[model samples]
Target: MGKLLENHSKNLLREAGVLVPKHVVARSPEEAAEKAAELGFPVVLKALVPVGKRGKAGAVKFAQNAQEAFELTRELLAMTVRHFPVEKVLIEEKIAIAQEWYLAITIDKKAQTPLIIASLKGGVDVEELSQSAPEQIMTKSIDPILGFAEFQAKELWSELGLTGKPLTLATQALTCLVKIFLAKDATLLEINPLVLTENGDVAAAASVMSVDDSAMYRHPELAAMVQLGSERTWRPLTDLEKRMVEVNELDPYRGTARYTEMDGGEIGFLCGGGGGSLLSFDALVSFGGRPANYSEVGGNPPERKVLGITKGILAKPGVKGLFVAHNITNNTQVDVLAQGVVQALKEMGKDPKIFPVVVREAGVNDEAAREIFTKTGVEYYGDNATITEAAQRMVERIKALEISGEGI
Candidate 1:
């Protein structure tokens, strides 16, 4: 998923009719100091990195004068927190906070539903507060189809014990936040410390984070803000990622592939559909095997797309073993996936015998897929094999090959 920085997040909020502070982005310390002077004293300077815990990492600072602003700007610009180098800073007018709270709308992948999390306690770690005082956090799940109605937001405000204009302001903010979350196709939209001023006005004072990688196509402006440095390096995408992103945008009804690279042992996975992936991951971990990547080729993906996905897994480095496992209830063909795997290996100039591939396809077309794998010289397993069994088999195969000093 794509992570938006403070500036990009603020733009989305402002577009949704949420009241955010007047702010300017400065590339240099001099520019930041000048912007702070223009905005007046007691300004907040935040490093423009697409990561959370900036405040805890000392990436966020306050300046009461132009001199302090300049100093803070220089320090932040040169600082590297969590491996993300700060190149720009946001200078915003400091709002006088009367109260603080949390508000967020996100899709619960397990529940397959939209969820809203809120708290009366603001301007602090919600997790920390929840651990120390569990009663403060309020959470609700919303139907994706029905969404958050106005009454639902109002009821949330009432439950928080907010009164008068502040309640109205909060209700309005909640409604707008929901709209923004839906409109942007966001996976997560969080506003930590949604502040209420003494003047009875609501403002998003701090910690505005959003993850909306899916909506990048519709919002070119937001896509442009995705930083091209270490932020991308962590889960480095290959040429396939760029292609799949384009394919995702073109196909309205196609399944999505969430591909992220990881370092470790062999045995690349193509699992998931109704928590099977999670189970497989845990089983792999239990077997002392580190996955090469977390790649999910979702339900009913076309044979060609499956081929592309297999190619992606093969392209990954240190992936000397392959595990293609899916649940029995899933309606994907075994032959389609096996064909993809064989084609990818051939195109990459790798032999299945040398690479040690394992296929465990169940559900529809399982027999045909098993036959295909057998003919292609790839190891095949049946639906009766447990997750741990499949993982152990793949890991053992890799270990066998490694000990034999085989070249692939």
Candidate 2:
């Protein structure tokens, strides 16, 4: 799942014939004021970060005039919302509201079906809506094979007690939204306050969307909007994370290397084999070791790809030790993994012994990998040491290094 920023999702909605407020993205306060002036008075200024609950964080503000837009834009740009430094703000033409409603189309993962959730109770968070008045909210499941139909959309809004022009417009808007959701392979497409303007027109006042990354290959148009692997971080990708993305993309067909930074840790985690990495992380945490980052490198990556990821793993601040382990390989070559790790350590001028580097990889070419690791003065283990045992050894090595304060 990859979340699309508000501006991006709104633009997609507009393109699909769903009404949305006229908006522009401003990178600075001056730009915001200019855009506000161009869009007319009474504007909304929102911090353009990837996380939700911006209103709760005071990241969403209203500006009655150009001067207010300038001040609010400055305030928003200066704040960090949910760890993401605000670099841009969304300026929109504020609508005069008659009523606020809610509509969202998403995949029902549990039932493997498409789900539509709508509520007449709007201007409130969906969670709050569900909690406060569950009856006011309507939940409908669409058959994957049959799909959502025009009549189905109309019936949903009508059943919710919407009638006259609002009912017809809501039906059309939701139908379009559902089309957009399915067309884009979106995991979620939600309009928080599907507003009924004073003019009796429905507008998607807000949109929060996430698309399936596995289906991204089909959406070349969305490439620039979505940063792959964004689900791992609710906010923007850090510089290190970006580089790891590049390394992973370097040979898209061969292997995968995913990196995510964590707060306040010392051990540099380097592991792979998907499920194996999770277990490795658990083992490390179980042994009271704090890993600075989580990384998975696997699928028979070449030495350079492996080396690139290794360099990134060790580059995080406070990474005083390194722990590398993986499941017994099916196809990934241990010799290649060893070569890459050794090459990275050598290039980074790291002495494995004092720096606390540990590896517990096994399978095809294990003999070669073991020889290379030993020759490089790096602690080595094959299937002989369970992944858990390897993590224990890594913890002890880091402790020993802390006590000695000398390179091996």
Candidate 3:
């Protein structure tokens, strides 16, 4: 889940040969006014932010003249939509739309396939349309492997009551859009208010797009437009979060190391595996322990990757104790993990004597894992203790440390 801003989304559509309104980027109200004057009055001024519902948030406005454009641009620039402050404005020539339609391509997570949600009605909430008039909207599931064809697109529009030249034009637009969706490995590509101009030409008036972050490796061209790992936050990444991203990307390949900072907590959580991380977090919370940060470290990571993540977890303010856990690994070696954790603790000058550190890992090379951890003077457990029991032990250790004010 990686969302592209409106300007980026429009750029993608234009690159794919889709018709879009003539637009210009403006960093200030004066620039927006100048662009409005150059493009002629009656323009749309939209805030350049990644989050959605800009219209409802007063980030999207219309200006009928240069003066109005200048004033509205100032207003848009002042908005903070979904915690994202406006830094730029997109000024575009307003299209005289005769009709509006909706088209979107996304995944049906439950069905595990690409799906299309299209409707004859547009410029309105898709959810409202679904509830108000379900007959006017159609949901189509796409065969991701075989792909969507031009004929399939044509038939789709034709069924929605489009005919003649409009039908053909809409079909071509849909075909091109589908190609962009699949080729880019996008999670979402939606054209709301896909307008039919008064002159009877089809154009995409607005678009919202998000690509799969896991597939970003295959799309170097998108690097400049996308802020990698932006899917997790509505606002800009905090300094600590940015550092964590650097740590993970520095490795590129070897294993996974992901970290997300929490608001506030006392325990630093370093868990492994996708499922294991979630279970660890839930178990900690269930045992009345607050984790300062959430981390996922797995896939048989090398010492460097493990140490990088472990240090990050413990660096968060107020994190006095560390809780590390992972499920029974299939391929991940517990010894390698133990080495990384111990090295990070030593580098950070953390001693189990003062700082409570609990590790529960049992997998390949468990014997070595136990030995390394115990030698480091860190509390360690193997398969004998369930993950839940390990979580309890970590909580108890932290509580005793807090009572004694040793690490506080």
Candidate 4:
């Protein structure tokens, strides 16, 4: 998933002919004040972060004048909502809302189709509203092959008690929004408090959007706006994590390499595939091992990719040991994986003897893998040793090092 900040999402919505409040992005308190003065008074100030629920986090505020805007922007800039530091403020002219509505488009994974959700009530939590007053909300599923039509959008709003001009304008807005959602290959496009102005005009007051990262190749223009690989993390990517992204992207199509640094740990973890990585992590933790990072190396990756990710895993501060494991594989070459792991250890001067490296790789070319690992004094295990047993061995080695006063 690639989540776009509010400013970027609003820009896309505006370009699609949707009515949105005039907005400007300000990097500093002074800039915010200046923009607020220029755009006229009574503006909304929101921290420009990819995560949601900014209002609940106190990252959203209102200002009636330049002085208020400056002070409020300063406060917003000092906030870290959901672990993401606020670096920019989105300042927009506050619309006079007569009514607040909600609208959202997303994929229903179980059904494997596009889903549209709308409600006459807005400016409140949609989940809470659904539980309290389910009758007010409407949901429609669109066929991927057939697509959504303007008539469908009209019927949706009309059922929610919209009539006359508001009904027509709301229909048009929904139609445009659906088009943008499908064209951009978005996973989610949400408009909370889709407002009806005091003057009886329909407009989108706020938006949150995320596009599918796998479909990114078709949308080069969005490359700069979307924060790729953000879905896997709650906080902003650490410097080491960013380096790993570059490594994985080096050979995007050949295989998959993923790395995520943990808060603090002593063991550097390198596992294969998603399911295997999770099971290995759980097994290690269950055996009193603290892994410094979570990583997956699989899909017959080249030695270079493996080497790059392994180096990153070990480079994290406080990583004193390494643990490598994989399930029985039919495609991934264990010999090639061994070459990368051994090379990375040599490059980092991490001796398996004192540093505690354990390997439990099996299948394709396991015989060659075993020879390579054992040559480096690594505790190598083939299919005979289960992942759980390998994890227990790794923890035991770390314990032995601690007892001997020869810790890495």
lDDT agreement of model 4 with the native = 0.91
Q: Top model by TM-score, which number? A: 3
Candidate number that wins on lDDT, 1 or 4 = 4
lDDT of 1 by residue, 180-247 (tens): 87877777778887998877799887645555565566877666766422223543245656655554
lDDT per residue as tens, model 3, 1-408: 667888888988999988999998998889888989999778999998877677888788899998898888888888887877888999999999999999999999999898988888998889888888999998888896898889999889989999999998899899889889999999889999899999999999998888986677788898778755545545677788778777776556667788888889999999887877888899999988999988888777788888888998878888888988888887778888888888888888888767888989888998998999988788988888988999998889888877876754
The alpha-carbon root-mean-square deviation between model 3 and the true structure, to one decimal in Å, is: 1.9
Pull out the clashing pairs in model 3: none
Local distance difference test, each candidate:
0.77, 0.88, 0.86, 0.91
Q: Which stretches of candidate 1 lie over 4 Å from their true place?
A: 108-113, 139-152, 211-221, 225-252
Query: Which residue pairs clash in candidate 2?
Result: none
Best by lDDT: 4
**lDDT (tens digit, per residue) of candidate 4 on 333-391:** 99999999999999999988778899999999999999999999999999899999999
In model 2, the number of clashes is 0
